[model samples]
Target: MVTGVEAPLAVTRVGVVGLGLIGGSVARTLVAAGVDVVATDPDGATRAQAWDAGVRTVGSAAEVLVERPDVLVLAPPLAALPAVLAELAAELPRLVADGGPLPVLTDVGSVKAPVRAAARVAGLEDRYVGAHPMAGTEESGFAASRDDLLPGCTWAVTVAPTTAAGDLLRVLALIAGPLRGVARVVEDATHDAAVALVSHVPHVLATELLNLTTAAPARALALGLAAGSFRDGTRVARTDPRRTQAMVAGNADAVVGALRDATRHLDALADALEGGDDAAVTAFFDAADPVRAALAEAAAGDASPRTETVALGEPGWRERLVSLGAAGAVVARTGRDAITLAVPPPSPK
Candidate 1:
């Protein structure tokens, strides 16, 4: 049964499938929060590290399934998702015969829709939920993972029509209850489209900018002069190219649309620069001022977020939750009768 928002996470154990940066950080974070974590990764060195962090390390996904964790987090690379799902499907029969409840399966994939489709094909859709944490370094591997990554980050918890209300609340327990992070509920399609503009296109732009800088005629001069903008834009470009490529491919349609829009804007800016249109250039920055100021205000925490109770269990409550997330509010506390959300801080006028 769902408890008050402030109650400790009742989940006895969480099983993580891949102990890479995202998964490793989750395992460590849960372990630190006093949750028992059992995980499996192919790399022995990575498994050893997770074991040292107090997580019980297993040899494979099937072993973890046998252990019957309350939540099973699938964190393999996108390309590995199909095979991983297949293995889980094969392991299900053995688990079900024990006459115990199955784990609530979730994933930390960047794109949500494709992962949902794969899970649907494997017949795991009923119990599956999509989650994408809006935090992570460009770095990969278990060694680079930090338990502290969970706090203050927003986790986009995507759900479909078939998702159980109880299952949804269970994931929220992990995100808000123990991890001390924001839980934003969105539909799978909404998540893919929004993340494309906010995440994938930026990754592409960062990589292209780094390439442009590398091939410059005065490459050494430019490298020596590079500062905050250059460094910040290209930070995600330092990620392992292969993984980034797969993430982009997983959401190719949305990324393509976002890229075309970006290109159109860039072309207009280039035209303005070439013509030396001072007025046009000034207009561009002038229009962007509010967003810049709003972001600054957010960073400084100048405006405190407001809170109120939003009722649940109505016929259309799930859709209401989606509206809350799209409106920038995060679920602050979930209860049996209602959910309390913290409305986003005000934007600068």
Candidate 2:
């Protein structure tokens, strides 16, 4: 009974575990969509906030499960998924009726393979579908969540090998229903590898760049003088290190594989420079420029240039960035905690 676009599943009540950014956003979205959402977070303040926002609040994930919600959305960080899934696996049978259908389970963990593997080990693979909404700012927690976060994003939905068809439909309905995201059904391993290349490795590179730059000289001045390009390239570095470390650890093989490939490309550029082969350097840029453009286009579905966010760390940072516009920086947002600046790739020539 997989109805097109209308979302075939009847998800009247949702129990969301871990009211972090993704979890909170999902909860808010579902509530706005007229679904009753019961959410749990370990933080008392967060629980109070969810209650304020008209969501039923519980103190623990186990308590959320006790409600026996129609669907359970686990939105914890990658490091927490295994234990969370294990807890859900143990609690479901005791709380749910013996012959009742298992509660549909889904997660917003970025890395999919490890989660799917954990679910399989817990014997909950048929009930779980892995989802990663490619959205969010460097900010974390429930306070930073937004209902509009997922709409324009490409959400990766992964199906485990043992996933039941109905279970997959229920997950799909959840993604399309309240999230309003483009549900791209990707294989679990492929999704992991894809994100490793596009996300995990890039975060590692951004962190490395920030570390190298700040560790050198006049750290404050260096950061203060950072242009739009520097800000755009290193934005991801501001994310919580614990979460990034969890992602890197969970998808170590894929991230390492991507890093090796990046190294090969960098080594080629270094070789070209050492040999003073201007043409070879030009060739490299020529190959890369269009690929970057294509990637941007594919992600955003826009012919317009891409913008990147930079934190306005100080009162005078706006004046500093606006000054760069006279020198080619395309600043977008002016008053937000962070500002968006259009940063196109360098010209190949």
Candidate 3:
């Protein structure tokens, strides 16, 4: 009987088990939407912040479950997800009957496959849907949380066959109602692969760039003069180092694959430069022009969603182009069979 203008579903209560940026934002949004929100965090400061913001605070995950919320969001670090899910599974049945069970569970981890595997190991896979909301600030913690952070952003929802449809819809409703966008359903593998290319690999690359610059005395003046272009380019590198390491390590294989592909692109570019063929350079620049244009269009919200069909033809060419686009790289069709995708040139590292 949850009745409110913003409440899309009958979720009377929601539990958020980590009052960090993502958790705090979700709790605040639900509370503002007229849903009861119970939040927990091991850090007393975070809990206090949530309480100060008008959310019901709890001592632990156990107490949150005692409320038997309609949904539970595990918003811990990516590496901590396995242990958290395991702990939740152990305490779940006691809080609610097996028939109704505890609340449907989901998480805001950056990676998915590992989290899904952890849920399976914890015996809570059926009730959980892996979600990656593509929104964040460089900031972290409860103080940095914002209710409007998720609006107009794309959230990837990964579901397995065993995931409850009702539970998934309820979660989606919460997101759409308060966050103001539809959750894009994607396979766990596809979601993980795409994120590895765009988010994960870039973090590593940015860190490498920063590290190389810091190590070189010759680059001191260059680093000082680094402007909007450098700042924007290396923005993700400014993320929490520990968190970045955890994300990159947790999804090692995919990140490594992306890095290798990126290396190949760099080698090719170097070879072209060494050869000093004006025609080759011109062709490369011409092909790259469109991708740069497309990226600008995408940033300006002008790029239409083109449903390009992938048919079997060349072995690696089409896939490479598509991967470029998926990685937030600029890709444009040069001709019928030929296409060009711009790669971000390697920095010092």
> RMSD for each model, in Å, please?
3.1, 13.4, 9.6
For each of the candidates, give the backbone clash count.
Answer: 0, 0, 0
- Residue-level lDDT tens digits of model 2 in 212-313: 896877988888889998899988887688877877888999998989988898899999999999998988788777667666665764345565554545
Better of 1 and 3 by lDDT: 1
Considering every candidate listed, which one attains the maximal lDDT?
1
TM-score of each: 0.90, 0.78, 0.79
Off by over 4 Å in 3: 1-8, 95-101, 279-349
User: Worst 10-residue stretch by lDDT in candidate 1?
Assistant: 1-10
> Which of 1 and 2 is ahead in TM-score?
1
How much is 110 displaced in model 2, in angstroms? Answer: 0.8
Q: Which candidate number would show the highest TM-score if scored against the true structure?
A: 1
Q: Rate the local accuracy (lDDT) of all candidates.
A: 0.83, 0.73, 0.71
Model 1, range 1-349, lDDT digits (tens) per residue? 1123453437778999999989998998898888888999978988888888777899999898888888899998877888888888999998888788789999898999999999998888998989999887578888888889877778899988998877887788777766677788899988999999888888889999989998999999998999999999999997788867887888999999998987887787888999998887777668778888877777776356787666667788788888777877778787755667777765656
* Model 2 / residue 14 / CA error / Å: 1.2
